[model samples]
Target: MTTLRILAAGSLRGVWPDLMAAFHHQTGLTTDTQFGPAGLLRQRIEQGERCDLFASANLHHPATLLQRGLATDTGKFTANSLSLTARRDVVTKNDTWLSLLQRDDLRLATSTPLSDPSGDYTWQLFGKIEQAYPGWGERLKQRARQLVGGIDSLAVPTGELAAQWLIDQKHADLFIGYASYAPRLIHHSHLQVFLIPAPFNIQAEYAWAMLTHSAVPLATFLSSAAAKTILRQHGFT
Candidate 1:
């Protein structure tokens, strides 16, 4: 049996274990996986890391690979959105998403931009927030703790989600990350998940490409409704 090597985004970590198991059961093909920020994964591939498939949290990375002739083509297989995840005990009862984010005393954690799409999305959201309330964009960005993303995110322990662990360590009062990760933290950690309403929400687009044509079946399977159902069950919109 051939072991397909897959490079995927970190936020997908929560879903991949079971998803890969199901995929293996269905196709009888073994897989070896690496998960981290999509941009960094793209960098790895650019640096000549061998991978059979490339799954990214945003369209840009995979499209970049295709443009550079490193991958055959790309397909968007899943979707996600950004949300504010706060430690339940630390937030005030009346805190709305905006209010909580605006609090002067609040500490916000975000992924590192340019290295993680989640951070890039958070920056986009800051722009949207500025449109709603001028001057707040720069304020939020100035205060946000870039705890994850870039090469640093690659250091996050296996099976341990970054934001959840950060909250547990009292690093920040809240964090902005993929909504897909929110559900797991809420269930397993003392966290509260809040979806940023439309007008402020940044829609996250996830895509994948075949670095090696032999991995096409895995890409097709990921795009199928069966895979989508599993993703949705895990909180990916």
Candidate 2:
């Protein structure tokens, strides 16, 4: 069988390797995988990069490819929600979600907005917080350090999850990212994860699309029961 090339979102890094190994075993087709910010990956494919399958953190990227005639179709395989990862003590001490984030001295970190859907969801949460608290949207935006998933993000080597790395390096007291990544973001045993509140929660949809003219039919495999089981194991709904 031919080697299949796949470009996927960074958030799926934890599970993709093992999942694809299973795929290979079942189909006898080897795959070459690349993972990065979803939007950036989409841009690369749009720029004529060769890839058989594109899996993204949001439908928008694949939908754009479909409209551009770069992909045949798109289908959602899993879904995730935004969440906060922080030091256990810090989370336990805060009585309210907004208050924790609003603390004057606390440093917050998030993926870059517009470049990564996680950052976009973080911005949406800020907007909701602004609605509830009044005058805090701009404040939150100003204080958040865009550490990953932007045009200017520090160069993270391929296959590395930047948010988890930043948290491990103690770049900030808190990080905003996909809930599926919470387990990896906790650098220590004491780190904790908090679900984004109902009002601010954004369910991130992950979708896959077969590139136009690609010989590999990965879109159908993405929807298979085996794939869904692996996604769920990685925290996707």
Candidate 3:
């Protein structure tokens, strides 16, 4: 049996294992998978890394590959939204999601833009905030510390949640990341999860691209009801 090669976004790490297992059971196909920042993975593919399929946290990366002739087809598979994860002690009784972001005394951590879709979405959220509040968005952008998700960013230890690890390590008082992580982060005794409200939040579209004809079966499987059920179970929309 030829094992399918898959490269996926780091955000999918929690769900990919189960997804691959289901894919194998249903189709009798094996897969070898790697997870990392979607943009960095796309860069690797562009540089000639071989994979049957590439799944990204945002549509842009996969679309870029299709446009550049590096992929044969690309389409969205699932969706996610942003949320704020703050250390329990850092949040005050008077704080709202917006206010926590505006406070200068608290450190704000985000993924690195251009190297991660989460960071790009955070910037997009800032843009929406800017539209609503005039200058606050740019201030948030300036204040945000790109702590992880870059080519040279600190490596999050395996089996650890990025938001939890970053906050527990004292890197930041607050982290804006995918809301899909809320279930896991909410259970942490020292963390508080806040859902970013509409008009200020950005929707992250996860897309996948076929790098070779051999990927068609896996790509098709990704869109099946079983796959969607697994995605929803893992907090994807």
Native-vs-model 2 lDDT? 0.81
Clashing residue pairs found in predicted model 3: none
Candidate 1 — which pairs collide?
Answer: none
- lDDT per residue for candidate 3 within 1-237, as digits (tens), equals 799999999999999999999999999999999999999999999999999999999999999999999999987789999999999998899999998988899999999999999999999999999999999999999999999999899999999998999999999999999999998998999999999997778889998999999999899988999999999998999
**Tens-digit per-residue lDDT, 77-106, candidate 2:** 899998877656666454455667878677
Candidate 2, residue 8: lDDT: 89
Q: Which candidate has the highest TM-score of all?
A: 3
lDDT value, residue 152 of candidate 2: 80
For each candidate, the alpha-carbon lDDT, in order, equals: 0.87, 0.81, 0.94
Q: What are the runs in model 2 whose C-alpha is more than 4 Å off?
A: 89-94, 156-164, 185-187, 213-216
Error of 1 at 54 (Å): 0.7
What overall lDDT, based on C-alpha atoms, would model 1 receive against the true structure? 0.87
- Alpha-carbon error at 177 in model 2, in Å? 0.4
Error of 3 at 74 (Å): 1.1
